[model samples]
Target: MSYDAKVFNVMVASPGDVLAERALFREVIHEWNAVNSEVRKVVLMPVGWETHSSPEMGAGPQEIINQQVLHSCDLLVGIFWTRAGTPTTEYASGTIEEIEKHIAAGRLAMLYFSTTPAVLDDVDNEQYQTLRDFKASCRSRGLFESFDSLAEFRNKFSRQLQQKLNAHEMFKLTQTESSSNQPVSDFMRLTVPSLTHEAKVLLKEVSQDPHGRLTYVRYIGGAAMQSNAKSFLDSKERREVAKWENALQLLQEEELIVERGHKGEFFEITAKGYEVADTIIS
Candidate 1:
């Protein structure tokens, strides 16, 4: 089967009221696009503009950009600088609505980054409170990522993106390693202990026959030793019979012993069984 390269669309949401946050968002998207060809699209919401030349465009330029940004992207990246004044109520409304739309469409993954209030001048007590509210909102919706600084954000974003991309490759490698053949000795070493414990339990049950040696084998056969009934020894044991029977079937299917026509069947261990038994005893 052929695989197609996947394209990632990123949308950045920032408190447009803060110049520093707007600048940072722009810089990050620009740098990300330059480095990762897979990230085919990047859209920034209202807080993205630096300065507007035309006042005639009307007062709702930010709202218009917010709507456009939401419509264009698949993933939303929220940059939270608590010190930056809370996004205007209008910005918050637009973001919340966009988030709902993305969720309904099953097309959204969200990441959040928070910056220290002390680092930005406009970030005040009221702004911090607004950020706390925003953080709480994100937590309730289970949409968040956190960073201590811009540098941290850069590092973490790259790491997360790489992990998302390489996950399938890693899984495929694990499957390949598991399927490659291994030596019988290696298989024996891994399987013997558990097999020995199981054999001991089965042998113990066989040894418990109240009849003579010939009748003992007969009892085992009558109990359908070839079936899963070996686990029916106790009150709660019936449920586990199928599991025991499956294990027993593996041993029988390997021809570990020959069954002579039902004159009280006798078990003469095969060469394979003798080798396995000797290994267990030693």
Candidate 2:
């Protein structure tokens, strides 16, 4: 098939220590492409110093990389595990320089710090300390993320990538045009949660009812709650049960659900409740 795809160059920046993460970058890009390429008609290409061929000397290594790769990326994904990397002429480290440069140009970057336990013997105290200092400086420079393991990093990055795509005007426009001729989705008007875990679970439970109603007693008692439910509202503790009661009342006041009967023995999911549930289930 002959087609044009919007191509975005993503620079993967890191020191020598995060080799596993560096590889994960490529895997994530490929995973994203597999799902998004045909649907979104967008291609994200990952670039790094290891993948680029430049003269051994002339300008500094980082400078050569800046000219050949980093400057051209549409997005930057920087990772740090232990080392802050080797110093450069104009900056403390090449990775830091790349990040600052990207930020200065008003581009996008996602910096991640791995908190997974490391062996004391394998760590260089000076470099680890430098990484910590660099992290502190980054607070005002741009937004960053912390991950405990590769699995968490993958999950977080996937969400972040989708969010970035949604926020891009061109991507939004493409999606609009693509679906303009189709019927609206059931999830078209859905509003995602701004409620507590307990409230969300209660709301979703009511939504799943065949008649759009649930017994108030069953709701608070945690009847048929999901295995992954996080709330402790069903516990015998009076304080926790009261918390769930408060959430239930709040939902009623918001018109997402309605309390029926003189004794408030039943609750019915409203149109608003269904809308919110679609956001979670879809």
Candidate 3:
């Protein structure tokens, strides 16, 4: 018997900074295909400029990439962290140009912004500001997802893949059990609420601590959140202190960190917190 499967090209569009995270995006797709492709009669092929684009010189670099791969993209995933990308003749960056061209052609696009803190000294001021502006503009156009940790990124991508297949007509999933022989996944924490970037960073930092603790100490004129041999609070400024304080509170609210002794003073990372921290340590 012969079978048919529809293969959709998933174009990965991002600047150079997020190369590490970019691979994770493709890994998720490969996992999904391994699990459901045969049953669903659909396949997702991950495509990117790094893997697909070739050397040629007729037009600009971005234009060449567009002609080579962007024209045929079935789905566009635009990821941003520090740099927006090198500017083109028309758009903010090469990645943005790919996204704009793909979307303008009536294709689906998924955009994500990474919240992992970047060293301010190393970041290019112009490019970084451009990325911020684009991130803000993106909200007005359509739906998008934000993530702070690699662990959270993987989970969100998996969940989003499932939801998209179920919703999109081109890749509509066959109505059936995900797998009959396999047991339910304990790792499916889809119900787990998302975390703010600040909270996630603090959680990671604390997880790296020898005691795995997040402590808030109030002094005569200042307060600070200390963990992993570092202090987040630098000055006696109220605004800076409040932001770190809120991050501590958020980690507690999410149950990722539990109070070790006194409330608000000593909170240790939970088992689940370590699980997440492991994936994002690099």
Candidate 4:
């Protein structure tokens, strides 16, 4: 019952208005996996905060959701309609924050803004304006598509998903060829990027947490991590703070840790991160 197929987690991020689009997204992803998984040797798993996260407290609610769900996504699909989504401290809405974070990681983020006309009374002028601004921002950031109906979105998504799979296959092939040509030592170096001492120290500190979570902003303060993180950090150079920040970003990119607080102020040790740190500590 064990098959070796590469699994890609696709995060579907959206606001309240796009209920139909969200449902269609799940259907499309299911179809993709069913049709393409066997032949392609890959499966696309759809992920979203609503399904992935349970109730938790500590940082802002949205931040916690991000840490749990957003960090693990291999690809992000953002859908927007009349609603721009509720405001957050950092971005106009949580969806925006999620999409931006995913894109900032130098990964793929596909945004679909609905252009279908709506009744004047049903639309919130302010919310629509915010959505417009975000759509414009998307144009500057990357290419985005629009659909007038759910049917259209479904068709477009299927084509796009196929293209993505094709690209993934090419990338794997390239990596395989490149690795084959490189020396063992060179391949090892290329595969494993060295983790900085500060990053290791921070990971070590978080690894000690009984609850397996840390307040993102508070961790910057000495008291949050107690003498453990502080002691190690204090022994380092004057740029320790910057090093810590860099470590967090690196851990994030490596999918070793997840952040949950607004403006990325909360973090927790992901299972993968914990395993790595456990090995190091042992």
The number of the candidate with the highest lDDT is 3
TM-score of candidate 1 on Cα atoms, chains taken together: 0.41
Candidate with better TM-score, 2 vs 4: 2
In the range 137-158, model 2's lDDT, one tens digit per residue, is 9898667899887656754665
What residue pairs clash in candidate 4, if any at all?
63-260, 216-265
Candidate 1 ranges with C-alpha deviation above 4 Å: 1-8, 16-63, 83-105, 115-121, 165-282
How many clashes in candidate 1? 3
Q: What lDDT does the true structure give each of the candidates?
A: 0.44, 0.73, 0.77, 0.72
Flag the better candidate by TM-score, 2 or 3.
Answer: 2
**TM-score of model 2 relative to the true fold?**
0.64
Lowest summed-lDDT stretch of 10 residues in model 2? 223-232
Model 2 C-alpha lDDT versus the unseen true structure: 0.73
The residue-by-residue lDDT of candidate 3 on 1-282, one tens digit each, is 454567889999999998877988988788667655655566889998888999998789899889888988898888888999999999988888898889889999999888989899989999999999888888889998888876656556655666687778656433333333334455443424477677778888877775566778787878767888888888777877787788777877766787766545877665456555655634
lDDT of 2 at 79: 95
Backbone clashes in model 2, listed as residue pairs: none
Query: Where is model 4 poorest over a 10-residue stretch in terms of lDDT?
Result: 219-228
Model 4 per-residue lDDT tens digits across residues 132-248? 998887776668888887756765675566666556653366446544655455434443345787677777676665444555444333422221344434433446656766777
TM-scores, each model vs. reference: 0.41, 0.64, 0.61, 0.60
Clashing pairs in 1: 16-47, 83-123, 112-145
Residue 190, candidate 2: Cα error in Å is 18
